[model samples]
Target: MPFFVPVGRRLSAALGLCLALLCLPAFAIDAAPADADPAPIALDARRATISLDGRSQQLLDPTGALGIDDIAAGPPGLNWRLRGAGERTVLSGQTALWLRFDVLMRDTQAHWELELARSGTDAITMYYRDAQGQWRVQRAGDRLAVSDWANPDRYPVFSLDVRPDETVRYWVRVEHARVPFSGVFQLHDHNTLREQRIHQQFVLGAYFGMALLLTVVALANMAVFRDAAFATYAIYISLLGLSMAASLGVGGQFLWPNLVRWNQEAEFVLLPLMGLVGLMFVRQVAQPRRIGRTLDRLCLALAAAWLIGIVWDQSLPSALSLQALSALGTLSMLTIAAMLGLAWRSGETWIRWFAVSMVPVLLASTLPVLRNFNLLSSNFLSQYGIVIAASIEAPLLFYALLMRSRIQHETQARAHALERTEPLTGLTHRPHFLLRLHDSLVRAQRYGHHSALLLVHLHNHAEIAARHGREVADRALVIAASQLRAVARDVDTAARLDDDSFALLIEGPVKPDQVLHTATSLLANGLRLSPRLPAGTTLRLRVVAALLPDADSELAQDAAAHLEWMRQGMLTLSEEPRKAILRLNF
Candidate 1:
């Protein structure tokens, strides 16, 4: 001011002052500062196990071009973000992902293992340094046969050794290009890891055992009853059990350990197959056509779609196939629900209970579908939900099948009764009587025993019907049937041979005299007055008896010809004045 500065100079002085003030904080900061490293995870006496979800750092390789050396170099461009707040690590659309973490051990010596808890990853490689300062690598995942993995197990496992106060660095690379990747990583000591694996296997064993038991029961029922529903149920459960095994990695680890391609493709194929068989089972049990023709056709179409989906899945990409199958599964569940609902509304009351039984399995099945679509993360429920629910569903479904079988048996028994018995007399009809007679005569011939056939003709049947109404004549026939049943032994067969004729087959071990006595009893009983008949009415009978298995006459060995011979004897006796009993020994 005292030097009389110009206006522009004054403004420039102010700007210089402002620039120095902004530069003061930058001058205070140190250049070449050390990189920020997160604190190492401690595995001490109190912390024997830990999950790496929130503690580990992850780097995504979009093109999967990075190698172990590039990851190990910690390039400035590689940004690793902490895997925070979630139990599962999920990365979509990336060809590979790298996980890095450091573990600090305070124990004297510790044997630890790192487990990637998901089973279906394409490939996984672990990079670390041994105590000898030499780089080491371990390989595991579905691309390689389970038998060839660094550790052959249901899940990929890597071993680690740390001394007291030693800090070890680890790098894990995951390659999952076919589908979205989701995994859980956990660090555990040797004993804890072993115990957990044993528990898991034990639980899986229980589930598979239950599935086997159910399948056996279904097959047994199918064999005994010859029900298509039971057979279909057995197939459905078997496929379902195998599908779950593949999904849980048990198939890869134990069933087809050396079949790397099949192990990867098994779940994709088995799920559709299981669904198809399940739909067929529903059709057998529900018989949806009973509800509506449209509903039935829809169910058939859905099942056919599942069959086609099996073929479609094989030709499509893995991710696309999974998505398609998930959609199909969801549609199948809905279709089943609709079919059951329509059936229930149409008065299939028993189907209500079946629908109730289906709820748990349908819900459980949806969990895996959700997982396949990446809508749900992998967990115990997602992994084993179907098995647990199937344990409940299997028993209930068996009960439903039993109910259905019983109903069918009862209906068939009623139909058979109607077909074999005379409706008016409630006695064996002509066809069934002939069948029994043929059997009895064959047995008598085989054992050289005596069997007798007694034939009675109601001589006054026409006269009585003419006098009274047909109703009174029916009462007389009923009386005759009751008398026949009362005189016949339990082992003997009482049958109505024709409109006015009745017959009693005395089974083997009978003397001729006994046959004569039986004929006499029948004549005497028919002669008695029945209160149910019209007043002053007596049943006059012409009785004929033939001992079966005549050695000389072939007619005696044949049921029809033997009965005709007895009828001829009755016709000959018709000419007699008196109602008489005729016994013929051939």
Candidate 2:
């Protein structure tokens, strides 16, 4: 306290001490061991292949202004980080990435190729020094036409030439603007690479062939059944197959090799379009209105949003577009998941099959999106996951469609049957009976085939109803219906035309004698006693048979007029005798 220094001098001393403390660590770090250069990967007769991903170092060019010279000069503080074990090099944001690795050749005769195990990069440039000590550049990617690539292939490939016992350092510049790029770097001999490509192509061809077969089946169903569900499924599968082709680089390599711009943009456009169509297919098949109006509207709204996303993706920058598409894809999957839950809760049993089929595809489809978003590393699962999953999903989905179609067909059949048949007797009602008669008459006229219509009248139906009750009268009508059905053959049509009149159309190849025999059988059956009727009550029937479509008859062509002729014949027979059979030509 007694030896106080000046205030300015005290502050200066404390600042000097703080500066020295900060400088001390910097000096110590500089004096510490420097990081050694990574050893060159050796490729010899015993080991002709190696994975460059583990041996490489990566540098990010934020502004994308760095050139080969700048990278070669080893600028200070531009630290190149080593790739960790099993780590994939991922290109993200708006930045370009540079990868450096060295390969030592032991066998001079072997031709080598470096392969980037992915196909959707925007541009990839490989830089190396040749024997003459000049920098050589080779380019390949979706941005460049496949025909113009240094090596036209499903993946970016580069030829490597080096002398025996020489170590060649390589610099790979990867720029993917629209999406994140993550891939494995492999050095394979030329023959081995070709074999790999052939195997890959075979597997992909099998998958696409299966997809095409399923799509053809769907289209055939659409045409035959005229169902919107089948049509929507066909479109969805087609777009999904095309999108897979584009993502796998098969489209660029074989489909449209010269369309560089379209090749670059195809994946982005097709993926969302697939989602849109897939939603439509789901809605058409699910018929969510059976569950609730809210679910139906949700499906429509989701489809519209996906459609909007397809257009919006084109307007955004490459990175932003990828991000947006990835987000939308996630939302789409979530929407499907939610629909599955709602369907389950609402007891949509058919949707259970749909939900089960979606599991593998959903899991497989998510890997690529995660890889695109840099949330997952590139691997076999991320690259070919959809292909494997689609192979399983396609067949399952086709089966689901078949089940749904069968259920719908059965439902429609039941509804139609209810509309056309009489409720009490389960026989063709009056309107449908006339329609069948008209069809039969037209066929008989066209083919010159003989056919007959028999009109049978219950003579005492009103007398029984007045004596017993309406129930007893209904029982008599039912018993009468059973007799007519028993008398009719498989090719014949039976109908309850009115309160007491029944009609039977015996289909073609019949003569008047056969018609007379049929009429006598009906009269005999009508006189039989039935336990279902009142005690001591026997049915009395007046029968009239009309042979159809007579060449000289004016009313032969008209089914209604011919049926009226049969009725008049029945009325005439009623006045003449009891239990009499009357046969007429019409």
Candidate 3:
């Protein structure tokens, strides 16, 4: 029984380690391309060259190379053609020759015919490269022979004798076709037969996968933080994914075939867009650090420039404006400065990582700007910088968010727990009351505002407790706290200052008449504990308050000091009893 696996997409022929495991055989071997009939071919002894740029040469073996290998096991064809010197380097027939092509198709094969006529008809052998980067030479190539006679795979070792000044020509034809090889799965393509195709697919797939992940991460961050910066970054990632796909020619070829013409424009938008969002996110989180302010300003400028570039669709203008990435480099350098500042002011490790991640990418973004303006070559610096940077960046950002939230929420929970709780009534505590007072005082000082503070006492609260087991007195206090809480606004903080004495800070920047009216409403409740208190004890519960203009800083700044003054100036019992009120000038 033969075991097998499945491949998903196109595979490149980096070194002809062509082994694909069949999970379910794709019963169409005979359906090989109709034009596969080979034409008598001859080798042209010409080689392509690159001056400074380097070309990659890899090894070829069929079984397996590394764990990530997607090709199948067990040799099937004559794989001993040529062994290149890379990771899978294999030398065969002691030494051999190689065939290199730029773009290899799936439906095509490089068919070779080596002739021995000039060499005295010596028996010659054949070889090819396997999927595991190994060289496999076969002296028997007759299984699927399309020739009338079984082609000689190899000649005996000394079968060839050379005459002086005589040269013999050998014919080697390749019957190669584009066959998709993704994770042991095969598909059809007229162009998948090249070694480089596999490499390109892996690279493209990694980028697309990363872009998608970053996009998802950005959205999740935004939803949690509700910050525009995160949302902007998310949009940038999505655009970047599209942009990268387009730039790599994959989007035009497979995904968005119709949008081929928009490739440059997509690059234009995505390149700057990522920076725009990154700048915005940085400005928001890092704030006005020394370099941060500068970067933020630069981002703002780039956004404007991009908008302008979009409005006027000329390549040069578009090119010139993107030089803003030069600004990004300067800006990113400044970010380093800012990170130093932030580190000194607040020790956050994530800030350092963020700073480091920005450098290469910011530099990369600058490259395209230079290239677009003819300052450099378009071949090196690409629109894919952000995609790559973002690929590495998103995880760092998520870690940063975790760090930020971990510390932030811990501090927030502590402050809320300690400051806002009332000791006696478990209501808003003295600290919270003081905070509210300070805020109200500041507002009043700014606006010449008038506000009121009321001090309430359980009149004869000791006498009532003396008569009622003290439990009823506790009940009365509970009732009062509940009533005050029920009447409180979202801003109000009610606090118990002492036994039987509570302070109510009421914001009354309104007219003096409205202040008086609001006071009347509060006192009208009659403490509501009449039923909970002694029926005939006749202990009076009264509210004593003083209202002062908020601008009276000296009278309102210190809670104990100012409140003491207000208590001293408390109004006596008005004839209406509960309606007692007083108004003062700042």
Candidate 4:
């Protein structure tokens, strides 16, 4: 859709050239016969001969044949035929000089032909549009239109055979590329009673299911990752797939019976919404900085617009706005692609790979967009692209998660190695106090039954270390551990929680006051902290404690609940940690 402006630009240029030619002076275009012989020349609009040439023995139009102009809004009967070339002339010539008189109008339609005289023999290899909206060749007699015969927009070719004096009524049928509704190929003839209905049901059910499932999965991942890119893209792709499928007629058949009116509006509305959401997704995924803020604004604005439109659901302008939204979304994609060029130049390999993933997704989805817009022919692939794209996209999400985990692991490794631990004192250095405390709480749950965390902050620790030197500081820490070990029950756990703060996990029924008193006594005076404690100094200690109600399997979960209490005071405890305790019935 973003690409369409250029197409329109080219169309404008072409229209200018056409008007120039149509209004200019009359002249004869040299007619080159297929066999190097000569053929009659038709009227040229520039020559001002609007009259038909009666010399070519023309074949009448088929009774049901609608001229290309009749379908489009210009010259109603401009789509006509030239007949009466001999069977030899039709078949023996290596190639025929066919003139395709394409009528450009709303979307557009085209018709033209070569005079082939004889009954059909070799297959007529003519290009047709598949449901996916790409141009492809089909056998003349092939059973077509499961996908509306979407021929690529190009010059026309006609092959026909006529018997001697026998009239051949070859039809040149053209329609605007089938506009996909809800991922379904448009239908031209639906008069069949049972057959069309059955096929309609099966196709609609299948595509709708695929689209719905895609939507759910995309939304689910968005919820999990909270990745704006993922959420935006998933919504876009799912809705695009859904809108495309519904537009195609096959999907909508289930919701609405074989009726003309109901299908039109639904297709119109979904097309733009899909484009809006999808473009937002691209901006996030691609991280095109230039487009990011703009896209973000567009998404917000479009969302509001859609809400308004939904309120006025009865309007066709709302439906047309979808096309505009789609164009806006396409702009986002182009912006991303441009940024990828920078991502490559910067040598960001991961971003580069991610950019690669988006290319295929865009190309695949584009076929359907082009089909829906009547810009390209039709095909059966409207829903298939989403399935393929989602498969590719799912892996990218996992890769992102893996990259995050790898980064986290490396950070933790560095922290573990760099942690400052006192080898002699077995006390954590100040630098590692927080990390050790966190790790201690994490590992202590195995035996922390009815556990109480006791934080003993020794007063005058620096003075003693300075007076006795490192030797006395070492001895004091060793002695402190030993004294605590002697008093601590076998069920209790102890750690020199910090350089000057030892932590005790008292089990069973120990009182907080008892722990505090013992901490003060063990840190006795003459604990000569640097001989600077004014000679006969006693150690003062402060204590903090946290009590747990039970030991539990989900101690981590419980720990999370108690984190706030731990942060608030010198001495803290919580009952939350015990809530996750598991009891064996045996």
Best by lDDT: 2
Q: How much lDDT does each candidate structure score?
A: 0.79, 0.79, 0.45, 0.42
Quantify how close model 1 is to the true structure by its C-alpha RMSD in Å. 17.1
lDDT of 4 by residue, 506-586 (tens): 554545455555545544522535342244545545544555543333446344344334334443222333221111210
For all predicted structures, in order, the TM-scores are: 0.76, 0.77, 0.39, 0.39
The worst-scoring run of ten residues by lDDT in candidate 3 lies at 176-185
| Candidate 3, residue 28: lDDT | 23
Candidate 2: count the clashes. Answer: 0
107-189 per-residue lDDT for model 1 (tens digits): 54567889987788888999998889788899998889999999899999998766567888899999875455666788888
lDDT (tens digit, per residue) of candidate 2 on 207-248: 989889888999999887677788888888899899999989
Off by over 4 Å in 3: 1-195, 289-299, 313-346, 373-388, 411-586
Query: Over the full model, what C-alpha lDDT does candidate 1 score relative to the true structure?
Result: 0.79
Error of 2 at 388 (Å): 2.2
**Least accurate stretch of 10 residues (summed lDDT) in model 1?**
25-34
TM-score of 3: 0.39
Model 4 error, position 64 (Å):
10
